[model samples]
Target: MSRILAILQKEFLQMKRDRLTLGMVFMLPLVQLLLFGYAIQTEVKHISTVVFDQSMSIESRDLLDSFSSSGYFDITGTAKGYAEITKMIDSGKAKAGIIFPPDFAEKLRKGETAPVQVLVDASDSMVSNSAIAVANSIGLLKSQKIIMQKTGVQSLPYDIRVRPWYNPDGITAYYMVPAILGIIVTMTMVMMTSMGIVREREKGTLEQLMVTPVKSYELMIGKVIPYIALGYLQITVALLVGGVVFGVPIRGSILQLYLLTLFFITASLGIGIFISNIARNQMQAFQMSFFVFLPSIMLSGFMFPREAMPSIIQYIGNIFPLTFYLTIIRGIVLKGIGFPYLIPQVMSLLVFSVIMMTLSIIKFKKKIA
Candidate 1:
């Protein structure tokens, strides 16, 4: 007990002396929460739009009003012709273009189908999807209203309404901030711990540890305790920023959130220590950490849905500790789900941590190599 405590104190003291690492431990999460929280928006609004209305009639104006009132499209300016609309879109000044022909009003008056053109830049899938769906919905609703007025019908045969749960408004921050917390922990735990042992080895301090009485598991526990505290600190800062600045709701037990976080933190720390054991130098450790980091971000359903991915890719993602942690964090934070519902994910992370820690300890040599 005293040996483990001594190692723990030594690590903490060394960490305190390392100013740059200490600064990063405090600063990284806040910066990431602010940057990603504001930037990564799934529900795109106020898309820059251009209009070309040759009908010069109230009907044309009303159609434009429909698009504008939907709040998806923001009419920036009017285009003189198709050429100008094309130029605006091609030059990136507008994301969507609405073109109404001269006969648009006449066709509607005569009870004929009015042909209108909507051009969208589909380069960015998220922005383009919002523009396309809202534009089509506006046109559909307008047509339905016109039909109802002409026929004097009060209602349609079937009305299908959508009610979104959790985040009804589709606020991206609510969804992203919790996941960002998981990602922050993954980055620091893996990168920092992996580099720590490598740096010790590079500086020949690892030899000093070989002569000490501490066992490998004791060394591992002592090294990991400080980082566990650091992990909680990062999570607290991120949650505060997310809640105060972004209004992200915490629907479940805060105790559950903190307790479950332990499994994930230890899982990530184990992976880092495993990397440290395998790496020959700090540069190698960083490279290995980045190699794992990229896939954790990509395959862990951070930017894309695992359901939408190929079955093989989904299987690969399941191997990453971050994948399970993302589910646990988002489930507790967003859905208010608790223990029995989360048992599978929690168990998976536990198994992962145990396996990785066992491997790291086995790989760790007590003698100078």
Candidate 2:
């Protein structure tokens, strides 16, 4: 009993000296509770939308108003044509596009059913599904209203036509592939760099390297380049597996995917290097990497819906590199979108890479003492 008590005291003393580790130990649980509690929601809302109202009639305008007022969609822009609608969706400018055909009101007024094409960017299945549901409900309610006014009947008279674009069937693979790519990069980049640094420390090579004439920035570059190559290799393997094993189509340019992935790899490697600087041993490095991994998987819209999360948790997720990377990957893979549409995600990734790499370099110390 006395021996155990002495061991516990020694451990506590060690922890007291390592304030970062101690702080992480105490703060992680509380952070997880708050984050998961608010960020793990399944319900999606406030989807951004665009309207291409070719009809320009009272009926078509009323229908558009119905959608905007429903609280599910925020009408952000007005598209001029079908091409513009497609452009908006591809560029991540809008989640859904509501198009009213030229004769929509005429057909409806003539007692003939008119089709309103709802083009949904179904890469994010949760948001797409929610938007489709809301659109259908609005159509049905409007039809019922027309019926009640014309025929004194409360039944629905017209069909609320729905056409989900991009992913017509809403396959889970279509939605998950891009997100899984983000997770893979995060796990491999962080774990490999952390473990590699810790191994160097364990073998006493880190001290030897420090004594060499290599500049700090040069050494950092050398360490990161190899990991960046490894990241590309992992992406290649994962892409192949997704295509062959899961039948997930690569609709966009492979070169674009690789370039975008390069940005993400660097960002992830930056995080790993930062963790390596903080952790003293391999076990500690592994623990710290896991701490980062769990939140990333949960909060970056990888497994859960970001819309369901409280506003604060959603904002917290924006800090992660994966959150932006997922958007780029999904846009390319599922929507066949190019740089014009992917600028925002690319910019976000660039900013993240710059910040993380700068922080890691700044935090890196040249001497063991």
Candidate 3:
């Protein structure tokens, strides 16, 4: 009993002297809570929409008003022609486009069937599916309202034409593959870097390295760079699997995806280094890595819908680095959106990277006691 107490006392003393590890043990959970709680929303709101109102009549205008008032579609601009609608979708200016035919009002007035065409960019299958469902429901409600006001007879007057672009079937794999790539990178980079340093500590190599003339920053760089290369390798493997096996198409520029992934990888590596600096052994490092990993998978809207979760939990999910990376990768790969549309996610990743790397470097010890 006394011998066990002695060992415990020695371990606690060592932990107390290692401010980095102590701080991490206390701070990581709290920080993760605040971040994931606010950022992990799944329910999509404020979808950008474009309208091509060829009818330009009271009925067409009233129907457009019904859509905009639903709170799902945000009417950003009006398209003058069918070509304009296609352009808006291709340029990533809108997620949905409503085209009213020239005979829409004429047919409605005569009680003849008319089709209202809705074009949706279905590259993001989840978002597109949601938008389509909402649009269809709105159309049904409007038709019912028109019947109730006119002849007091509720009946279906016209069909709402829904055209889903890019992915007609709304395949889950198409949307998930790009996101999985981001997850793969995060898992590899963080786990590899975190375990690498702790393994050195367990092997007694960290003590020897500390006694050398190499500075803390130099050692940190050496530790991180190799893992960055490994991250790229993992990314390559994930992309190949997504493409060749799952048949996920790369609609956007590969260069763009790679560049954005570089940024995300660096951020994840920073987190791993932070974890390694604080963990006393490989077991502790693995525990800490899992702590980060579980939340990332759940909260990042990877496998589950963020909106379906309670608001508080959704917010907690956003703090994981994977959450923002998922958004960036999905936007670029599925939507073909450029930097202008992706600035918010990229900035968040950059901020996280800077803070984590700074904390790790500042808390790093130079002398071996």
Candidate 4:
């Protein structure tokens, strides 16, 4: 216990001495919350669109008004032909092109299904999805309204209503902020711990540590405990900022959320410790951390839905601790759910922590490499 306390004290002192890393520990969460909270929006709007209306009629103008009023399409320029519309989209001047045939208004008057072409740049999937959904919805609604007016019927034969839970207005920040907190903790815990140990090894401080009476497990625990505290600090900052600045609701028990977060923090710290054991220097440690970081962001359901991914990729994502943590944090913060719903995720994190810590202890050498 005394040896562990001494190592813990040594680590705290080292962290204090490294002002830049210490600053980053506090600042990174705030910056990411602000950046991602405001920047990454699922409700895509004001897509730059080019219109080519060959039908010079009041009916065509009204249809254009419908598109503009929907707030999804912003007509910036007009094209004379499909060739010009394609060129604008290719040049990045527009994301969508709405081309109406010469008979668009005539077809509508004759009670025929008007074939107005909508070209969307599918390179950006999110933007494309938004445009496509809105465009299709606009067409459907307009057709329905026309049919209702002609038949003098108030209701359609079938009506489907969607009620979104957690976020009623579909606010992206509300969904993203909680996951961002998990991501921040993961990044700091993994990269900092891995790099810190490798740095100590490079500076010969690890050799000094080897000569001490402290055991390898004691060193690992001491090194990891401080980072666990730092991880909590990061989580606290993210919660405060997310709640106060972004108005993200914490519907569940704050105590339960903090308690369960211990498993995740420890799990991430173990991964870092494991990385430190295998890495020869700080550079290698950083490389390994980066390798882990990519999968966490991409496969952890942070930016995209894992359900949309291939079954093989989904299986690969389960290997990462962040994938489970995302479900836990989002479930707690957004849904306000409790332990019953979280047991599976919590158990998974616990198992991962145990495995990583065991591997790290086995791999950690007391002697100089």
Candidate 5:
């Protein structure tokens, strides 16, 4: 009991010695939250578009107005021909190009189908998809308007209404900020914890501790305690930034988030400890931590959806604790889901925590390598 407290005090003292690093740790979440919240947007808008209106008539202008008013396309410049639009897209000057045939208005007046070509830079899938969808919608709406005017129909026969829950505005931050919290926690636990142990080993302090009367598990717990505190501190800071800066609501019980966070933090810490046991120095620890970190970011559904991945890839994603933690945190923060709704995720993290901690404990020898 006293030994664990003594080790905790020692770890805290070492951490206090590096005041700059400690400060940086706290600031990590704030900076990343702001940067990622602003940068990562799934619902991409304001795509730079080039227009080539051969008709240059009122009908063509009306279609251009529809594209511009949709907020998805911004008419950056007018292209003289298909060759110019091709040059603009290839040179990265514009993402999309809208071209109206010379007989566009004539076809509309004569009740014939007008062919308007929309060229999109498919290099970026998101931008291309957005441009294509919006262009098609604009065409559909204008066609319906013209049909209504001719046929004298007041409204469409069928109405399909969509209700977007959690974030009705499709605000990227509301979805990303909470997930960023999980990321921050993972980075701190895996990178910091592993690096801290490796740093101790590099400084020969690990051998000094191992020579003491403290049990291996006790020493592990004591060393882990400080980082656990730091993990919660980071979570708190990230949640605060998510809520205050991004207006992400904590619709569920904050208590549930904190509680579920324990399993994730411990699991991450265990992974870190395992890395420390394998790595001889801090550089190795940093590199090895990425083995876990990169997978957590890519496979954990942080920036991408797991459902879209191949079946085998999705199964591989289950190995990362961050995968489960993302579900728990996003569920609690966005969906207001309680522990009952998060049993599978919580259980997965619990199992991971046990497995990783056990492996780390068994792998860590009480002697110098």
Candidate 6:
């Protein structure tokens, strides 16, 4: 225990002296959390829309007003023909185009189904999907009103009341901020730990410890303890910023969140130590860390939904500890669920921690060979 504490004390002193590393350790996560929390938005709004209304009647204008009033579509300009609409969409001037038929007014007056064509640029899926959904909703609402006026029915027979849970208003921060916390911890644990250890080998400092009587497990513990504290500090700052700046709610038990986060942190650090063990230089360590980090961003449901991915991709996503931690953090922070409901995610992180730590201990050679 004393030897481990000695190693721990040495690490803290070395870190303190390296002012640049200290700055990065604090500032990197803080800056990234603020930037990503503010920058990443899922709900697309104010789509640039072009309309080609051939009818030019009160009926068509009324329908167009509905689309404009919804706050999703902005009628930036009117197009004379389909060619102009297509050109506007292709040149990135407009994301959507609404076209009314020549007989749009006549069909409405004859009590027939008046079809309005909505053209959405499918280049960006997020923008296109929102445009399509909003257009459809506007059409349906208009149709429902017309039918009610004719038939005098109070409500429709089959009305599905949708209740969105967790994030009712679809606030992107509520979804993204908690996941960014996991990303921050993973970045420090995987990249910094591996690079720091590999740098020690480069500078011949790791070999100095070979003459000591310290066990491999003790050294690993020493290396991990300081980083664990740093990770928690990062989390604390992120939580404060997330709540204060973005209005993110911590609905579940704070103690449980802290307790379960240990498994995730250990799992990430084990991966870092294992990477350092395999990498011959800091460059190789960084490359390996990026290999882990990129997937944690893409495949781990950080930027995209895991359920939408193919089964094989989702299976591959499980390899990273971030995948499980995302669920845990999101559950605690947003869904307000406790340990009883988060058993699967917690157990996955626990098993991952055990496996990764065992591998790291086995792979960590005391001698610089």
Question: What overall lDDT goes with each candidate model?
Answer: 0.90, 0.77, 0.77, 0.90, 0.90, 0.90
TM-score of 2: 0.58
User: What tens-digit string does per-residue lDDT give for candidate 4 at 163-193?
Assistant: 9999998888998999998899888889988
lDDT tens digits by residue: candidate 1, 34-91:
8888886777899999999899899999989889988999999999999999999999
Q: 56-127 in candidate 2: lDDT tens per residue?
A: 999988888888899888889999998999998999989999888899999998989999999898999889
Model 3, 187-304: lDDT tens digits are 6678767887788799998778668765666666666665565567656765676677657778777888888887788789888988998899989998999999988998889878
Model 5 agreement with the true structure over 181-293: per-residue lDDT tens digits: 88988898999989988898899987787788878778878888899899899889988888888888999999988988998988898899999999999999999999889
Stretches of candidate 5 exceeding 4 Å from the true structure: 365-369
**Candidate 1, which segments miss by more than 4 Å at Cα?**
365-369
Model 3, position 278: C-alpha lDDT score: 88
Per-model TM-score, in order, reads: 0.95, 0.58, 0.58, 0.96, 0.96, 0.95
Q: Provide the RMSD of all predictions against the true structure, rounded to 1 decimal.
A: 1.8, 16.2, 16.7, 1.7, 1.5, 1.8
What does candidate 5 score on TM?
0.96
On residues 192-283, what C-alpha lDDT tens digit does candidate 6 reach at each position?
A: 89988898788887788767777867877888788888899989988998899989999999999999998899889888988998898999
Clash count of each predicted structure? 0, 1, 13, 0, 0, 0
**Best to worst by TM-score, what's the order?**
5, 4, 6, 1, 2, 3
Task: Kindly state the number of residue pairs that clash in model 4.
Answer: 0
- Candidate that scores best on TM-score: 5
| Model 3 TM-score on a 0 to 1 scale | 0.58
